[model samples]
Target chain A: MLAIFVEMFSYDFILRALIVGVLVSLCSALLGVSLVLKRYSMIGDGLSHVGFSALAFAMVLNIAPLYVAIPVVVVAAFLLLRLSENGKIRGDAAIAMISSGALALGVFAISITKGMNVDMSSYMFGSILAMDNSDVVLSICLSIMVLCLFAIFYNRIFAVTFDENFARATGINAERYNALIAFLSAVTIVLGMRMMGALLISSLIVFPPLSSMQIFKTFRNVVLSSALLSVGCFLLGLCVSYLWATPTGASVVMANILAFLFFYSIGFARDRMKG
Target chain B: MSLISCQDVTFSYEGRNVITGLNFAVDKGDYLCIVGENGSGKSTLIKGILQLKAANKGFLTLGDGLRLNEIGYLPQQTNVQKDFPASVWEVVLSGCLNALGYKPFFGKNEITRANEQMQTLHISNLRNCCYRDLSGGQQQRVLLARALCASHKLLVLDEPVTGLDPVVTMQFYHLLKEINRAQGVSIIMVTHDIKEAVSQADHILHLHNKQLYFGSVSGYMNTALGKFFSGGGQDACNLR
Candidate 1:
């Protein structure tokens, strides 16, 4: 069994799948810290729905869905920012409005476009099984940019995520930093849509961070642990999905959740024992 | 030179004038206290100073060489911040970002400053504590330590005494007074506790009817309006 597993890891498709999974997982883990800390954990889920709408619209217009979805999700990301800043609508409400409306619009578009054939199951779950080289390249590029940006402004972004006014007072340029984060979040949502899909993407973004919070003592630890956990989950889930012939996105999401639960329970037990 | 000054600053929310023609100033090292009824725009005025709200019309100036980043502010109890999952150390270290002369990540110097402030605030025991696990007073003290870390020159606080018992409130006030006197850092604190502000402040800023009465503590005691407010009179005190 060990030899079979080792052999499978060397196969071209499997290697590509693992790489894509790890890259996307790291992206989600990096962004998840800010999102969860900002109490905007739902941002990924909402933006992914917008990605779905853009994908459907692109399908109707015969344009590349990734190209169309990028602008759409990024714009929706900005809209959420604008509304929340307008000081009338809070983050969660803004996310709800965008997510529900985008999902509805996506469904409506898919219903109307007769010639635009889509595998609904693939959209509902993810179609990581069907990724081409271009999709893999996009994931790697997006993940690298996202990770690097976080690295460059890790302190300022962490401060802003936790407290905007404080970040501003510290000369962190809260507005620009926040917008930059929102932009990256949108980009991640759109690019990751290919692998995680709309319905199941939110879990991938959240569980890794939640799980990482368990044993991590420092902020950097929490973030790094989350990234590592995400990568591990994606690899395991990819292999399991392939072996079982199950839906790829759902399998990966479930894998992440299971990993989260496992770590969460261990942490919980440790704390209880200390008591 | 005045450390901070606001001239004829009026602010409105949703087109309703919350404050009009409000004016006040603080000299270097002056401990200023603000007292007002609810909606008298105490928070609004502070928010204006923080640039959280734009005044309808006003000029705000910091003294020569006083960078905006040099100012440290603690806001009133916020539902948004209270639930955040951060540690006491994280909360306090945030203060040094203003003065660390570096980016967000802290080095040895910044950590040392954070640790020193925590000890000074008598919250060294809380260094590893979860912010939510602490009592309200403990949390406020940690936050106060954060403000202390920002720079020892100025601290602007809005109703910082909230969620504290009177004993802790006294301790908090004494700590502020010590910091102000010892470090020569000016303090501008907003509070509705008129009696306490009367005794504690070197100067008092009173807000009523969209106007201000900025003067000495004794001057505030002599005002008929002060008497009226302490009497709990219902003369637009809450509305203003």
Candidate 2:
């Protein structure tokens, strides 16, 4: 097993995929705690659908997919947030409308252009070879940016997530903080689309914090544990997929699901014991 | 000038007016209780004062070196809010976010201030407790302690004691009175319980069917509406 693990890193593609996967996991977990607590976890799923549609368009236009997908998804995220807040449409309704519409559009675009010479299913379910040297560098920089911004705004995000009305009353601009959260989630979702696939990317933004919440009682503890658990799960899933030739995205999500159930069982047993 | 002053304030929601032509001033160290029937815009008026809602027509000012974000607020809790996953310490420390600006983390003084607030509210031992697991009265005290960590000058609360038992309500009222009188922190609370409102408040702001009244408790007691209430007319506001 140790020899197999050592030989796995002999390939450059594996190394690149592992680096990008770990960084994306960390970014997603940092943003996930706030998003999950705020009941906006589904926004990740919604935005990833939008990213899929944007990627399809970029393929048709023969443009760099990341360049087009990042801004397009980010704008869609802001629009969704704005529409939800304006009371003209509810949050779940807005997400459902946008996500399904984008998914349909992506399907249509793919059928018309035959994915414009790109392997469409690979983009849909993710491909390990997607992380080239340039992709890895971009991923590193963006993940660092996300981590730094989250750290800088940690206290304010805590306030906003707890009670937005009270936070606003106390003179914090809750709307701005909310937009910041949406923006960060958008970037992470877009960056993660290549490895996790658009269909499976949201689990990265959801499962970690939820699993952490089962055992950790405080926000800080939950956040720290979530980050660590996310990276650990991703690494394990990547290695398992490499060994078994399984679908990487599904493998990672399965790992997270198992972790969630395990932690939930622990929490339930603890509660029962206390009783 | 008073610590907080609102003149000719009119608040509306979805283009429907909830409060109109309201004028009230909260002086330094004043304990003002706002009482009104349901749908009488009591919450709207408090939100307007907190600048959470913009008045359709009027000006609101915060004096005594208070800014919009510096005023502590303890909002009425909803079921979802009550289940938030945060520790008592995190909740209290969050009160200092307004002063953090672009800084990422809380400074030592901010943590100390949160500890002091927990101590003041008698919840220092519960700092590590999860907020959602606390009892209603304990949660309210934790929220009050969180609010106290903000400005320590003024607190705006909306229906803060709605779910507590009578004993907890009395104890909470005593805590508020102590904070108001001893600490010299001005308070503006909205309550449906007219009995506690009339008994504990130094000043009263009464709203009924678009009519507004603001004055000292003694002055309010002499008015026709106050006399009606003081004369055992418990159903006066609730009936409307």
Which has the greatest DockQ? 2
User: lDDT tens string, model 1, B1-240?
Assistant: 687788887788788888888777888889998888887888778777666667787887778467778778786766656555567888788777766565546789889988898888889987777676678788788888888888677789989988799898998889888988888889999999887887788998888757657888877767876665554546537636
Candidate 2 docking band: medium
lDDT of 2 by residue, B1-240 (tens): 788888787788888888887788898899999988898988788777787778788887888788777788999896556657789989888888777776778899888998888988999999899999999899999989888888788998899998899999899999999999889999999987766788999999999736467999989888878876655665566545
* CAPRI-style quality class for the chain A–B interface of candidate 1: acceptable
Where is model 1 more than 4 Å wrong at Cα?
Answer: A87-94, A114-118, A214-218, A270-275, B100-104, B228-240
On residues A11-108, what C-alpha lDDT tens digit does candidate 1 reach at each position? Answer: 77677777777777888888887787676778788888888888877777878678788888888888887776776778778889888898888778
Best-performing candidate as measured by TM-score? 2
Q: Cα deviation of A41 in candidate 1 (Å)?
A: 2.1
Question: Where in model 2 is the C-alpha error above 4 Å?
Answer: A115-118, B230-240
TM-scores of all predicted structures: 0.91, 0.96
For candidate 1, what TM-score does chain B get against the true chain B? Answer: 0.89
Question: What is the C-alpha lDDT profile of model 2 across A94-124, one tens digit per residue?
Answer: 9999999998998898789764444677778
lDDT of 1: 0.78
**Lowest lDDT block of 10, candidate 2 chain B:** B230-239
DockQ of each candidate's interface versus the true one? Answer: 0.38, 0.79
Pairs clashing within candidate 2: A170-B69, A171-B69
